[model samples]
Target: MAAVTRGSFSVLRQLLSQQYRRRCFRLQNFRSDRTLQPLIFRCDRNLQMFGSRALHTAIVSQGPIVQFKLSDIGEGIMEVTVKEWYVKEGDKVSQFDSICEVQSDKASVTITSRYDGVIKKLYYDVDATALVGKPLVDIETESSSEVIQEEDVVETPAMAREEHTHQEIKGHKTQATPAVRRLAMENNIKLSEVVGTGKDGRILKEDILNYLARQTGAILPPTPFQEIQTPGPAPAPAAAAAATARPVSTPATKPPPTTPKPVFIGKDITEPLKGFSKAMVKTMTAALKIPHFGYCDEVDLSRLVAVRAELRSVAEARGVKLSYMPFFIKAASLGLLQFPILNASVDEGCQNITYKASHNIGLAMDTSQGLLVPNVKNVQLLSVMEIAQELNRLQALGAAGQLGTGELSGGTFTLSNIGSIGGTYTKPVILPPEVAIGALGKIQILPRFDANDQVVRAHIMNVSWSADHRIIDGATMCRFSNLWKEYLENPASMMLDLK
Candidate 1:
């Protein structure tokens, strides 16, 4: 009787399997028809189905949130600092709108929005470091098809402040750029108390400065002069305001008897170096490892000065401001032709030396940002006039802080004119990858004995050199220096090597 009962259960299971197979075959046939497509739809309450098949539905509908990551800005930069943000959380932005600016080791670059959306979150604040390929901001895109439910989206600190920021915007809260806010923070001034004269009631840097001037009763020049008709102690506030009112000058008086003010112990403020300054720190550290051969000498520049003066008018007519830099650079390139080792770089193992074919001579510029050495490409092939033109172009870009990485790298040699800023001599440190660096001192008119032993005034300039001792000996460095000096002393000699 037990065997018969087991056989009956087995037969029932077999029949059920056959029935399920038949149903699946029918579904497959239904799917094959082009007109009859698989349909996903809500069934009765608490159920969803695709055709006749039940599906586990856990779909959460929300607008597409894009995490905008910091991208590589070229020149092998791995990271950047968040310099400024043009938009904050909850602000609406269009595609291609400049949302933020970042400072890399090379230069400052403004990043644009890739989507038309509302700024949902900012992952970084001003002056914060951001790595390439990491999210910088989150944006809720407008073009997303999915309908976003408020409860479905996660609320973050940045998003929580969005409503508050919106309310502030409606109430005409103080609007200022990041730069203006930084200035206020440095001076310990409150932007709320300072009146804004900028468009749409925005606080500017000038406003902060003016406010400080008024409080201190110091007449700051360039403060907008306004006539205050009301005169009294009551109207003093207006008169002291640097923006709206002119500062009132009072007669000087002796200080009252009181305890002497404590000697100022300078406050220590720490800040991470960014952009070119940061690059300099790393480059210089590596440069110190190279054993340097130092050399210094003087060259008579009387003929060079006269030659420059003669060409100045011609250069001005061509819209180029000619300077001693072009001649110095040109002469260096000419000297390199004779002494190629000066333009060569040694390998890390110090087993091989590379003599570069092109004389890409770098010029050290002292900019407001930091020391920048931008090279003129193929100086060996460029004429003095051409070099001068390139020099002007580079100087302009450097001054405006818009120089590119290509303009700053790939140098076979470097030249620094410390004389322009009032230096007699400087032992310039060599920039690696290529070996030698030269520094020129200020031109001085000193009396020197001529061939006839009579003292005469002559234009003299001092030059200091630093070379890789592993590759360049003192004798070779001196010989190279002499050749360069000879070219400068006789300005006409450089013309022979001009392309």
Candidate 2:
């Protein structure tokens, strides 16, 4: 009876196995595609359902460390020179506080802190070249938004405010451009003691010179500016802002900017491309990728010159500096209205043109640094006097290496006024992304026959253009130049079109 029962159990197990195999075969036959491969390997059933236990990754919660990278600092520039550091490692900084100063070949930009936190590390030193989109500085802050909320509710204590005031005193320097500071130092004058006549009580070189002139007959200093030297580490902020403020971990070991290596050419000494010139060369070399053509023409600016002379007193009253550049910028902007395609850029494939809405005309100004083409926004809406003021401001900032990135951005069209330095005609390089660039040559007093066939001395200015041949044809470029000339030559006609 026991043997019979064992046989029956073995038969039932075989039948159950047969049924399972039949179901699997049916399921395989009903499959839609042959893309499903035969299982040559198999994982454990437990692992197939839920992944391997030993392979689990543990999530580690950490506070946020934010990093600020250089981006479009010089309007699509690749790298920048680290000019000066305002904050050092381990120092607490609030949002929007000045962190460091970077010098582009075109201008100097003050980088601000992006977050309120303690600076963990500074990635580069002054005079160092930092690539765009690379790490600059790191700051450690709370990962949660609650910390920011808490900070907003908390008011700074009176003692803390007093301490900050004392620190400012220790810094003991006015916010002046590097040029002004250098002039003051050369005169052995402390900037703190100088009375500022500039905007926001900022000290200018003129202020320092005036103060020194009052003290003595001339602006020259009796003694040179002395340096306070210490053998070891210095803790407090120096009067010149010589060192980075407060080091939490490592104190900043920044050496003074080195003197550029000079090249001796027989009797004269010339320096190689150092700061801004180096940048200009690099950018211009890159701009060679564009297939550009040159256009040359002459414009009679007699009427425009007369108009400027008449407005000279009005400009002086309004505290605006009047120059030929303002007229050129305005005329170019208005001419751009007739030929909007000139104020545009071509697509990468040379397939499309992007017309700009605002006529942000860039003026190429010669500076202590190489030529900088800082643009003025909405040139159409501004009067010539207003444009002159903007030009003056940009030139001043460019000289001091204090021009912001905004001043260097949004340039739809460019004007090169090399005429100021006495050039007759020059095919200026096109500042890329923009299809067209116009250069004004020196205005020559030429004796020419008028419409009445009488010879007269006319203020004739030669203008040269460089336009991308891919987007702008020779005829279109010439027409645009003629339109620009008409605005300057016949100043009366533009009055009816002024919007």
Candidate 3:
């Protein structure tokens, strides 16, 4: 028989007699299962243990703390910079709810929670690089079912006693999300000493903001945390890191370290690279991949200007605004139809030229969030008025930093209106995959010789073209520019090429 040590809780045991058959025993107070407590029993052989205790105490928790790893959001994106956090620590979240927003080199993406649970912890702060496959946040979710293998169910008497022993479990550690911790770290606040008002005394982001408001002499009087707001030794490690980085050594000997200069000697304020600026760096680098050369010339836009003035009233009657850009876009599209090679791309191997069928002209719009070139697709099919309307839409989206999906691509050619912002001319860089890009300068009145012989003040605009030497030669680029100039000089020809 097994050693049946009496427990405080009644035991419903099952036993077998050698002479007879199996029998079952029942006791009072053993009606339902105890949720908070784990079932305990003495180790026995020749018999099995089974009961209503559906969960193991060792693994059973309020919920399982799962480390949410950052998966491949893009094509082999090695890391992503955290933009904003939607959920904080201790906040209950549901499956498919957005947890945070991250920006990669190509685009911005929102991260969603995979499990329904309360946020346990966040590993990285905003603007910090979160590496692929690394934990982004921890979610404590209730696990409905768990599997316990045969080998996993058994344990030694010593092990069973250690886990089953009654003891007080204290959660004195500061419970806060990564964003809250970042705020505290940035403000030099001590999280450990600040009292939390969250579940199980969890420190929330709101608590930190409240603490800051108090420090600024707000209506909320100083709380207990105010007493512990003195500068602590947390910054000592950073100071040590700075000291370690100063010394330099040579193959023979190293120079003795000296007192370092203050970092704030000249600088007043600084900020990290955000998405807008970061995108510029990445795109500009991509733009420089091909060997680019430029062509500069002035075009006679007098005829086109007259045409625009004639149509300006008509555009106004239709509640639409017309500008010189529409004329430029029209002339460029028609010129591209003549010189299709200018609207072509070099294959990946640089062996073949892929001429695009549609003339999607990218108009570079200067925005607060860097240069955005949202193209007007199928420009060859749209009239001058329609081109103006498309430009209006694209410019609006660029200004709002709301360029829609695929609006920035499918561009067979790009035109940068640098002259609109008061530049004589600029050697604009060619956007990737496009063979050539054009620069439109501010229109100015310049003295030029007329058909007879006398110099006359003419409406002239400087045009510069940057072409990829890989495919487009200087001769082809000059010919393309002259064709564009012809359309502008003879505005009637641009209309003739319509449709």
Maximum-lDDT candidate: 1
Candidates in descending TM-score order: 1, 3, 2
- Quantify how close model 1 is to the true structure by its C-alpha RMSD in Å: 17.9
TM-score, one value per model: 0.63, 0.56, 0.57
In candidate 2, stretches whose alpha carbon ends up further than 4 angstroms from where it belongs are 1-79, 85-99, 104-107, 111-123, 130-282
Question: Across residues 248-353, which tens digit of lDDT does each residue of candidate 1 receive?
Answer: 3432344544987898769987877777788889899989999887899999988887888788777666656677888889899988999999999888789999
Winner by lDDT between candidate 2 and candidate 1? 1
Which stretch of 10 consecutive residues in model 1 shows the poorest summed lDDT? Answer: 223-232
Model 3 Cα lDDT, one tens digit per residue, 253-317? 33534877867667577887766577678768878988999999998877777777788777655
Q: What are the lDDT scores of the predictions, listed in order?
A: 0.73, 0.69, 0.68
Model number with the top TM-score: 1
The backbone clash count of each candidate, in order, is: 0, 0, 0
Off by over 4 Å in 3: 1-78, 86-100, 109-123, 130-265, 268-283, 316-319, 452-456
